[model samples]
Target: MSKTDVSKKALLSVNDLCMYFDSAGRRIKAAEHVSFEINEGEVFGLVGESGSGKSSIGKCIIGLNRATSGSISFHGTELTGIKSRREYTEKMRDIQMIFQDPMSSLNPKKQVGQIIRDALKIQHIGKDAKERDKMAADAFRRVGIPVEYADRYPRSFSGGQRQRIGIARALAGKPKLVIADECIAALDASVQAQIVNMINEIKKETGTAFLFISHDLSMVRFLSDRIGVLHLGYLLETGTAEEIFREPMHPYTRKLLGAIPRCQCRILLRAANHSVRLSATTLR
Candidate 1:
């Protein structure tokens, strides 16, 4: 890829994005004037405290929530403006999401393989039932699940295993980008490591861009190529993981970094070196 290619490459772009909601007859701004770009195969981390509008941005990107104002573009085409139904479907097929709770996200009534196949079917990935089943099996295997587990319900697997199923379902369509919105926050430390490692392996295999939304700065730094700090619905800082960690520019960013006790931080950062684990109490 040349510099020209790099300059022109962007999987998702947001400019002056504003999301507002009506609360008790008053207008509440969730995200205000937010602007950023997620490049091809880039893991752009959105870090913030509770109610900082981190999830709002992710939702807006995928059309889960409508934007109040401003522009959002995907692959250089305006998503917030206009598009045909087929065009929208084709573009959205390449975007997937892994929610925070696998249990809630996965249907209890459906078998694991069925769950993955639903995604494949939605994306029109496979030509027939046989091919779809094979795709589901391949997805399960890619995330380290035995093919037999596909027959079982979500209740049979542990939390980590369920999350892996969630990951497999998200990857079933071979998406170009994935939004992992606090996906690992609920898991234990060891399980967090497992999920993170699996995500890394899959990202390597697929060259997928990830909008990794989370409050864990340490973990975000570990998994993200570029990290953005959001405070009070504002983007306070954004740069490479090294730049953000080595020298944060904003006061809010500095305060978040300061929350880490130096000695404890060294240990925590060491664990984060493995690319998982919360390792922080407050990030708001």
Candidate 2:
């Protein structure tokens, strides 16, 4: 589809979604009445602390975990009671996930080329080994990996490079929606920036929608068109980055902003310290 067409479509929609677990004979709700919409070509950030149901919601949308009650519609089709393998495979082709830890997500024993080619083979896109190899190489190049490295194993590559491979795997299916769950958290700061930029470029080029789950508010502000804050399985607030940063309406959001180290008092203290240091240097 054209970029304009993608911009006009709502790729995924969730309504009153709830996921419950039966724990020790007591039912616990991991996600409670969560609802949101991710438009095609837009980045939606789901920010929350650990155990706030962020990953749970992602798993539900991806069909890894079953929802207790709620509706998830993808491309105008409801994702409930998908009975046939063909239907499931059709949905899988349109949606893919990039896991948090690259080291664990990839198979250590398999060659990087084989790992990436597996997705295409499963989807029946390529006819033979040679065709799959070419497809894998194309995906690797798209994610900035050198084609020669495709023969090496995941253990041979650095963390950042491994993450890039994971990204290439996710893109191999030509998915319309990518749920990136802490995709950059395991990398160093500099590497994280590089991967984030890569994701941005790919999103612009392919018009792929993203549901980015992270605790880094700064990164979320930079990448997301809209941000949602979750507190104990409840969506405390949802707004554009500017609105959430400048005029947070919820008490939880206000507390989060207040805790950020960029508050007025912290800035003033740093400025005062810098001024004192400069004065001492002048005296010397």
Candidate 3:
């Protein structure tokens, strides 16, 4: 039996979600019967290989892609039942997403500050323009970006900086749940560590729930409170991060853990044994 926590009030619940794509009369099952819940102030990590329907689930939750079957509920409200524009907008304000690619997600033409301000305005967050501007700068500062960098365009920033900017924009709306889809995948090793630290800090400070989707098992194990393992469009296992890593129930889950390099696996086991977070030093 899956060991996902059922004690807390679910912030976001997905039930039997199936996403299929039609191409040349053939049906592609992107996600099949995926079910999980993310509680308030919790991080639920989804781990899978490429083409394993991880991103597809994120997109479905954020309304980017409509699922073929099943239901999605946020705070007891069914997503598909929300038809009114006002209601949809209000709901979206409570849920946000950070995409995999920072450069592709951001507008190269707009200043970094403007990007954040736009989100604040769209969410109807601040009282006025000046307040919105201040919020944008604050968002930048929260993400460890200098306020001065706000004037620069996305093209001027490094990949890590751009990703931070994307995170700033996502948090500007003050969303309750953030779906971070492979958020650190595009960055270099050092930058990835920085981003991971930032994410953990942000989650602690803001009390926001996260659906952190990634292929990196080590990173997922470090970051997630609970974890779901996916393979071939199916959810194979669900458990606490410690449970999943130490005593993986599914064969696929074991296969994934076994694929880790021997040196890294040693570090992972050491960290797990000590009940410590995987540090940047050990990750290298």
Candidate maximizing TM-score: 3
lDDT score, candidate 1, position 279? 27
Candidate 2 stretches greater than 4 Å from native? 1-7, 261-284
Q: Give the Å shift of residue 70 in candidate 3.
A: 0.6
Span of ten consecutive residues with least summed lDDT in model 2: 274-283
Question: Backbone clash tally for model 1?
Answer: 0
Write one digit per residue (lDDT tens) for candidate 3, span 172-228.
Answer: 877899999999999998999999889899899999999999988888888999999
What is the TM-score of candidate 2? 0.87
Q: After aligning candidate 2 to the native by TM-score, how far in Å is the CA of 265 from where it should be? A: 10
Per-prediction TM-score: 0.88, 0.87, 0.89
RMSD of 2: 8.1
Looking at model 3, which ten-residue stretch has the lowest summed lDDT? 274-283
**Candidate 2, residue 62: lDDT:** 89
Whole-structure CA lDDT of model 2: 0.84
Error of 1 at 47 (Å): 0.3
Per-residue lDDT of candidate 2, residues 92-145 (tens digit):
788889999999999999999899888788877677989888878888999999
Over 241-282, each residue of candidate 1 has an lDDT whose tens digit, in order, gives 788889888866766775553458676675444322232432
